[model samples]
Target: MSTSRAPPVFLLVLLPFFASTAFISSVNGAAHMTPETSAICPTCPYFLPTPREVTTPEGIPANLTCGVRLLADRKVSWIRRKDLHVLTTGDFTYTTANKFRALHLPGSPYWSLQVEKPTVDDSGIYECQVSTQPKIFRRFTLNVVVPSAAITGTREMFMKAGSDINITCIVKGAIRGAPVTWYHVLPRPPYTEEEVEEINAGGRGGVQVVTDKHAGTSWLLVTHATWRDAGNYTCAPVHATPATVSVHVLDEEVPAGLHHDLHPSEGRSSITSPPCSTLLTVLLLVLQRVAAVNEHGHWCSFCLLLGITSCLSLTAVYTAAGETWTAAQDLSSTWSVWRL
Candidate 1:
C-alpha cells in the first residue's frame, strides 16, 4: 500500500529533466542542422567601418559615410559634437535643421549623410550611433579649409623711387567678416637668421591699408616708394594662409659698382643708369667742338693738334657712353612692372 501511494513520485523529477533535454536538443538541432534558421543565430555586435577623419573644401558638398556589418534593424545616426544635434537617423535626415540628408542604397548595409554647402561653421567632430541594447557609436572629425589669401599681383614687384605702389589681397571661401591684414616682413640679415618683426595692417611709416569689407579684399599702398619700402610684404588673413610678395625699389640711375657686377644675361641689374638725355648731351658737345674746328680752318698747327686731340678724346668718351646706355636700357626693361 505504501508503494502504491508514492507511485510515480519519480515521474515529477523525471518530467523536468525530459523537458530540459528536449529543449536543448532542439537548440542543438537548429544550430547544426538548420543553418538558415534565425531563432538560433548567434548575435554579433554592430560596428562602423569608415574613415575616422575627413577633410573637404568650403562651399562644396560633403558626405560622411557610415558602413555597418551585421547591424540587423539597428538605427544609424549622425550628431554634431559641439551641440549634440542629431543630424540623421535610419535613412531619415533632419533637413529642416541642417541642409543634410541620409542616404542608403537599396538593400545595402551602409549609409551616408550628405551636407550641402559646407562652411567653416560645419567643421568639427560628428558622431554616428547605433541603437542597440548597449549603444555603439563612432566619432568622425571633419576639417574645412578656406581658400588661402592671394595677393593679386606678381610675386616680384618693382617700383621707381618716389612712385606709388598698390597691391590688393583677395580671399575666397573665408568666413564672413573675417579681417585681413597687411604686414611688412623682412628676412633676417646674413648668417645667423632671426625672427623679423611683423608690422600690422594700419601701415608702417609710409604704408597704408585700405580694406573693402564686403568684397573680402584689402589693399596695401605705399604713398611714395623709397629704399625702406623695398622688402617683403605679406597679406595675411585671420582665417587663411598668408600671401607674400617682394618689393624692389629702383633709383633713377644704376650705381657704378652694381653695373660692373651685372652680367649681360642676368635678369635685372640693381643699379639704373640715367635716361637717353645723357647720350644726347654728349653728341651735342661733340658737334659743337667740330663746329669750332671748322670755323677756324686756317688756325695754327699747334692749335689744330690740340683741337684734334680734344676731338679724339670726345669720340672715345662717346663710345664708352654708348656702351653704358645700352646696358642700362636692358636692365630697365627687365625690372618687374608694378600694378595697381
Candidate 2:
C-alpha cells in the first residue's frame, strides 16, 4: 500500500488567489449598484425623480422639474415633442419662446422649466434632455385643462310672466368659492361688441345681476320675470369659458285655439257638435210617443168607469133575486169597444 502523493503546488497556490479576487470584484460591483454610489458618479445625471405627468389650468404657470446631479459641464434643456422646439437651455436662459425659462432653485440640485400663462395651445409632450456623451432624456406630458362654468338648468327654460327665475352655475375644476358673474345677453344673434361691453360694465333696465357663491357653484336670481327679461343669460367667470341659458317668458293671454281642453298629441283643442236636424227629430218623436200613451190611458179609464158603475147597479138587482153573476165577459167587451 503505498505512499499517497500531495496535490499539485500550482493548483494549490492559484485557487486561494482566484477566490479572493472574485470576492473583491463582487463587493465592488455591489457598491457601484447602490443608489448613493450612483448619485456620486459625475457622468450619470438622473433626469426625473418623480411622476412623468403634469396637469395645470389654463392661464396659469406650469413648472416641470428635473433632477440634475453633478451636471457641472453638462447642458440641460427642454424640448417640445410635437415640434421639436427647444424651449429652455442651461440655467436662467430660454432657447425658443419668450415665456419659458430654465432656472435652478437655490441650494437644490433640481432644474425647472417655467411655462408662464400656459394655455390649451401649450398642451403636449415635453422632454428634458441632458447633453451627456450618450444623450440622456426624460419624457413628460403636459395637459392644460381649461376651467369651465356650466349652467345646470335646461338650455331653454319656460316661465310665466311675474315669476321668479333661478339659475345655477356650476364651476368645474375651479378653486372653491370662485366668483361667477351673470350677464343677460341679447336674445337675437349677432350681438355687437359695444353692447357686450356695456353689459359687462353695468346692465341696462330690466336686467339685474345677482350672484351667490357656494362650494364650487353660483346661483343667479332674477326676480319678477317679465317679457323684457326673455333673453340669453350667460354665466361667466374670469378666464373661463362661459355658459349660456335661454329664458322664455309666456304671454298673459293664451291663444284662442288652445283655450279649450288640451289634447296631449294635438297642439290645439276643439269641441264636436251633433247634427241639429237629427237631434230635433229624435226629441219630437219622443214627445209624440208620450202624448199617444197618455191619450190611450184616458180612454181605457173611461171604459173601466162605465163598466164598474153599470155592473154595480145591476149587481144590486141580481143580489135581490138571489142570483150569482160574473161580469168578466161584459167588462172585456165594453173595454174593447171603447178602445176602438
Candidate 3:
C-alpha cells in the first residue's frame, strides 16, 4: 500500500495562520501599488512663472517673489544685477544692509526678497538663483519712483481784472490716470479763517478745469477774473504731494511784486498814489513862486509860457502812471485849465 505520511499537528496548526498573514500582506501591497498611493520621485529645482515686474513708490516696502518647485536640499539666493552683490541666501541675508531681508516659510515653495524703504537707487534688475548642477536663475525688474506735484509757472501770479486766469500743474512719477483736483482758498481777514472750495468744469462760477492724464498736466482757467478770484490755488493729485500758487487780481495794471489787501468792510480796495500826488504838490509850490516873481506884470508872457510848459510836462508824467492812479481824471482837468 502506498500511503502518504501524515502532517505534524504543529504544522497543521500554524499553516492556517501563515496563510491568513500572507493573504493580508498581498492585499496591503496591492493597495499601495495604486497611482495615488505611490511615492513621488525627487525632481530638479525650477522656477514657476510669476509676475516678474514690480513697481513701488519710494519709501514704501517692495517685495520680489520667486516661486520654486521641488527645491529639496538646494539653496535659493537673491543677487542685485547692478552691483553683482548677493543680498540673501535661503532665508538669511548675506549683505549688511538693513533694508534687505529674505522671507520664506517652512516647506513653502515661495521665497521673497523684502526691501524696506526702497529708493530710486534700488531700482534695477534682480536675480533669483537656485543651486543645482547647473545653476538656474530668473530675472525680475524693479522700478521705484518718487511722486511729486509742481506748477509750471511762478509760485505767485498777477492777473488784471477782466483778464483770463491760467494755471497749470504738472505731476511727475505718479500713477497713470490719477485724477488731479483743483482747490481755491479765498483770502481771509488777518484774524479769520480761510474759505476753501473745489473747482470744477462748467461750474456755477466761470471757473473751468482741464486735465490731460496722458500728459500728466492739469490746467485751471477762470474767464474774466475778478478780485474775488484772488487767493491761494492748490493742485492736489491723488498720488502726489499738493502744490500751491498765490493769485493776485487787480482792477488795473500794477508792477510785479506789488500786492494789495482787500477790505471787505469797505466793499472796495485802496492803493497809495504817492508818485502822482507828490509830483502835483511840488509843481504847485514852484508855480506859486513863479507867479510871485512876475507880480509886477513884467515878463508876463514868459511867465505864462513857463507855467504852460510845466503843466504839459506834469500831464505827461501823470499819463505814464498807467491805470493805477485813481486821481488821473482830476489831474487831466487841472491840465486843461492851465492850458486855457
Among the numbered candidates, top lDDT falls to 3
lDDT of each: 0.63, 0.63, 0.74
- Model 3: how far residue 16 lies from native, Å: 54
Candidates sorted on lDDT, descending? 3, 1, 2
Q: After superposition, how far is residue 101 of candidate 1 from its true place, in Å?
A: 1.4
lDDT of 2 by residue, 1-340 (tens): 8999999999788765543332123222111123543533434444436567887778778888877665667788888889898887877465646778887866576878888888889998888777754466677788888889888858988888889888888877654456777767533323224123223325444444444545667766667876556667888876678899977777554344432212222332232222322333344444446657776756554654554665656655654454443355444544454344
Model 3 pairs in collision: none
Q: Pick the candidate with the highest TM-score.
A: 3
Stretches > 4 Å off in candidate 2? 1-44, 47-51, 57-59, 69-73, 92-94, 117-119, 132-135, 145-148, 161-164, 171-178, 185-216, 221-230, 251-340
Candidate 1 structure quality by residue, lDDT tens digits, 34-152: 23322333343344456777776676677888776666777878888799888889878774856688889977877787877788898998877767534556677887777688888
TM-score of each: 0.37, 0.47, 0.51
lDDT of 3: 0.74
Q: On residues 1-340, what C-alpha lDDT tens digit does candidate 3 reach at each position?
A: 8999999999889765543332123222111122222222124455667788998778778899998877889898999989999999998899999999999999988999999988999999998887754466778999999888899889989888899999999998777788999999986655567799888865557888989999889998899987778889999988578999999886654333323354232322242334544455455556656766767545654654565466556656644644244455546754654454
Q: Over the full model, what C-alpha lDDT does candidate 2 score relative to the true structure?
A: 0.63
**Where is model 2 poorest over a 10-residue stretch in terms of lDDT?**
23-32
Clashes of each: 4, 0, 0
Model 1 pairs whose backbones collide = 253-272, 254-271, 254-272, 254-273
